[model samples]
Structure formats: C-alpha cells, structure tokens
Target: MKIQEIREIIKLVDGSSIDEFSYEYEGVKVKMKKNGLGNAQQPSQTAIQEPQFANAEEMPTTKPAKETELIKPVIEEQTADLPGADSDYHKILSPMVGTFYESPSPDEAAYVQVGTKVTADQIVSIVEAMKLFNEIEAEVDGEIAEILVKDGQLVEYGQPLFLVKAN
Candidate 1:
C-alpha cells in the first residue's frame, strides 16, 4: 500500500521469471505485467490504484483514470561497417533489462575492448539490475570486433551488447 512496499514488489518482479503479478488490499489494487521478449503484440504495463475518500464517512473510491503505462527505455542502435557477414560473428546479449557497464566500476579498466581476445567463460561486462551487478560472459572464444552498446547505457533483455568475430 505504501510507496516503498510497491517499489519492493516491482524489484522482485523484475528480477524473477514471473511475467505478471497482481495484488488487492481493501479498496486498493495493484497490477504489473512484463512484455514477452520480442513479442510486439503486448506492451508491458504496471498499474497502481490510489484510494480517494469522497467524505470522512464513506469508503475510498477507485478510478480507472489513475492507471498509467510505464515507459520502457529505448537505446538507438549504433551503426558500424562490420568486416564480414553477420553469421561470422557471435553476439553477446544482455540477459536482463538493466544498465550496461563496460567495466566493473568507473575507476576500473574495461574487461574487454575491440580486438581483445576472449574465451567463452570470460567476464566481458556487467549488467546491473535491481541494484544487483551481474557479470556477463563471452559465450564463445573470439576477438571483440565491435562494442554495440555504450557504457552506463540502459539496455533491455536480449539486447546485443557486443559483436565478436569467432576465432
């Protein structure tokens, strides 16, 4: 019912595999739904109802006009003249929606850069979601050909972060 409680619920939903959640207490109602990856038909929505008391003696009234859509973050695709065909490269994608960091921290050097050789299990970057920093690994042994996303950029689930030319 409180703002902090609502935020906690949102954090839990964002970090988990659950696609939808709804809660109702007294006359207050809350609903949250996540859009399916690459599913253009359904857009993500989170609705919260604020109780409005018409008079001291009457119960709170809920209105549908209070519902609002949460705007998703969008990152423009960076264009680059790649050396080879698309199939010749391996894409390192973000596993969750979060802020992408090229390095562990601001003062630290990046895990990898263009032309840096990397192994399949090497941590190439970090994606911070719900205040939890997640290390993203290069799933294939390759040389970094291009860095697609910018550092500290807000990225979506399954968005490409880098293009590596497989060794």
Candidate 2:
C-alpha cells in the first residue's frame, strides 16, 4: 500500500481503545496491537482467564524429559518439595474460554460475591462463548475470599476465577 494509506491506518488504530487490530487483503495480513499503552497510563484492565478441561480418559499423566542428572544427589530432597507448600489454598479456576458474566448483565445481581458460601457443583457464574452460555460451577465447598473477574469481561483459558477459603 501507499505510505499515506499506511500512516492513515496507523492513525486509525492509535485513536481507538481497541487493542490488536488485523487487516488482511490480497494474501497479506497486517496486525498491530496496542502494547505498553496501558502500562504507561492507568492499570484498569481486568485480567480474565478460563479453565481448560479434557476428557478424563484422554488425559495423560506423565512427565517429559527430566534434563537434570547433575542434581541426582539432591533429587530426593527436591522431590520432597515438588508439590509446593501452598497446595492447601483453595483456587477456583475457570473451566472454559468465554466472556465472564459476574451477573446476568450490568443491571443484574452477581451470582455470588466475596464471602458468599458455595458448595461443589454450585453455579457460580456463566461464560458466554460461541453464542452459548456455559455455567461455571464451584468445584469445592467454601467461602469465597476474592473473585478474580468482573462482569462482561473477556476471559482466557485457565485463568484464576476465584479464591475460596477451603472448608
């Protein structure tokens, strides 16, 4: 394209809050995203994450390529702490990739808020993706200490959905 056209495109992107724009034509795709802009300004972006789930029968339980023979002597000691000490924390991770809906919408009440009691299989929120609504349930029974997402926010896979005080 012409230099003036490219400059205009850049200007179009720079003037909007939409991060990451892509244009494709004639087998050429141009993608640009606003990076470090939020960092330079305020920190209001709410991070969203969704959980990934595969069929239990299809999941594999194996470690690949342990490239650490030099620490053979410390292997046993290292193995002792492998599980990590904070394994006790109750984490409610997202179960799907979609837009996180804290409530039905901006005018509705959130399903459950911080300090709310929840049990296993309780519907905590809904994720809207691909024109479908997936209800996210609680995997454990506990009081919610913090919710990791806001209403109408786009979420990614395997993001922290909430922090629960385990019972």
Candidate 3:
C-alpha cells in the first residue's frame, strides 16, 4: 500500500512481542521479522520478501538481461581469550535494541560488577529505548564473570551483555 502505512506496521511489530508479521494489499506484499533475543542476528531495514505483481500493468515490461547475485561472504572467527570460557556460564542477552547502562543513575555505582553474586530477580543493568528505561534482571543465579558491553553502549537484541558463572 502506502509507505506511511508500512512504517506504522513496522513500529507496531517492533514494539509488540510478536516476532514476525506480514501484510498484503492488492498486488503488493510485505513481510517483516525481528531479531529475537540470543539469536545473534543483525538488524535489517529492507523488506524480506517482494510481491509478484499479478497484472502485466503492475509489473515492469522490460527486464534487465544481467542477473545480480546477492551472496554474502562468511566472516572468519578470531581466536581471542574469552572470560568464563572454561566454566559453566550463562549469557545475559539484550532483550531489545537500546542503550545499555550499568548503573541506575549517572552518579551511582553499577548494579553489578565482575565477580558480584546475583540472584535470579536481581537487577543487573538498564536498557533504555526511546524515553523509557527498562531494568534488566539476572534470569539465572550466578557470579558475574564478565561484562560484554560497556556502559551507554548501543546494544542489539540477542547480543550478549554479560557472562555469569554458576555458583
């Protein structure tokens, strides 16, 4: 349909708990999906699937002779020493895309640091999206092994924030 309508759909999908959404109008179609937590997915702004225009008038009459390949190269992994790699650890992934903060306030100490013991419901950090500040909790009981993200850094959904070693 219209670009504004598509934008509104994207905003609705992003804010809701739904992971995927699709809409169709006449000959046009659109599909969208979110990068859920712990998936290590990159954010995409482009439309996932394109519609096949039914009528000849709706489709472009002249087609290009050359076909374009959209192949992405595989990135090689670097061998760097990671903390808590030897022990049983749980990764705290970002629940949503936002600015991560270690402390509740600018002047206050961080909620939890390396080696700090944390309970399941304990607040470990804050992730701010728009004007709302969301408190992130430690979903598992453990000792903080490493902080993956720096304070005030922009974090993506499913990106690792902290590594916690089980008690």
Candidate 4:
C-alpha cells in the first residue's frame, strides 16, 4: 500500500472507537494499537508498518537493516551501572533476532564476562538464527561492563546485549 493510504487508515482508526487495527496487502503488513494511561488502558492509536513486499517474486534478496548493522553504537546520555560497572557505558545492541549464547559450546567458558577487557574485534557472544551461529563482536575498546542477556535467551533485533566502558 502507498504511504497516503497508510496515513488515511491511521486517521480513520484514530477518530473511530476502534482500539486496534491491522491490514495486510500481498506481503506487506500493518498493525496499529491504542495506548492508554497504563498497560491495561487503551489510548490513542499507534501504527506499525511491515516491509512493502507485494509478492513472493518481488521479495528483496538483501539482508534486513537489523541483521547487517551489528556493532552499531548506541550512545546514551545516562546509562545505569550494573554492579561494579561504570555508568558511562556504550550499549552493544543485537543485530538480528536470534537466541543468545555466552559461549561457543556449553562445556567451554563464556567468550567474555563482566570486567573482562575487550578490544574492537573480540567476539563476545554468539547469536544463533536459522541454524547458523553468528559471533557478535565488541565493536569498541572497553571492558565488558555488563552482559545484558543470559545464555540461550531469545533476543530481538536492536535489543541491548552488553554494556561496555571505553578503555
């Protein structure tokens, strides 16, 4: 669907009593929900649009934005400390949706732990997706301030996985 059509749907949904709306065209999907004062309450509508894939034959053969941007730096003005960590830490976010593992194998030691010094190219964790194990690296020079996810945890794209304090 066109951007104009999507905007129109959002307007219509916002003015009506409907609290939620979802539409799919070909391969594109759109979801909208109303957020209220709290988790249980419903308020103004929110819209989320999926990729614009009209058909299987026209599907893009490139990696999604989330998958290719591993090592992207997340700058936070004020990040809370974890135990013995410093507050001025850069967050390392996941590049794709997958299962997080701390080690190459269960019997081996973790790639890195809290307080472990790390360089830009050091592998910190492995994220498994579609039967492929992807090694996630520390994109900056720092100490492994904190590990945000546990082993085998299901993590989403862009989710924070580690907090690193620059050396």
TM-score of each: 0.56, 0.48, 0.53, 0.51
Backbone clashes in model 4: 2
Model number with the top TM-score: 1
Give the lDDT of residue 151 in candidate 3.
100
The whole-model lDDT of each prediction reads 0.72, 0.60, 0.70, 0.72
In candidate 2, list every pair of residues with a backbone clash: 49-159, 50-156, 50-157, 50-158, 50-159, 51-94, 51-158
Top candidate on lDDT is 1
* Candidate 4 regions with alpha-carbon error over 4 angstroms: 1-87
Model 3: residues >4 Å from true position, as ranges? 1-82, 85-87
* Candidate 2 least-lDDT 10 residues: 44-53
**TM-score of candidate 1 versus the correct structure, residues matched by position:** 0.56
Over 4 Å off, model 2: 1-85
Model 4 residue 23 lDDT score: 82
TM-score for candidate 4, residues paired by index: 0.51
- Window of ten residues with lowest summed lDDT in model 4: 66-75
Per-residue alpha-carbon lDDT of candidate 3 for residues 1-167, written as tens digits (9 for 90 to 100): 43324444666776677888887779777777765466557553333454456676665443211111111110111113456656598878788767899999999999999999999899999998766999999899999999988998766666778888877
Candidate 1 lDDT over 1-167, as tens digits, reads 44434555776777778888887776556777776668777665444444433444434222333122221322223324434528889888889877899999899999999999999999999998878999999999999998988998767767778998998
**Model 4 accuracy (lDDT, Cα):** 0.72
Error of 3 at 162 (Å): 0.4
Please give, for residues 33-66, the per-residue lDDT of candidate 4 as tens digits.
7666465466444545455666766554532322
Higher-ranked by lDDT: 1 or 4: 1
Ranking by lDDT: 1, 4, 3, 2
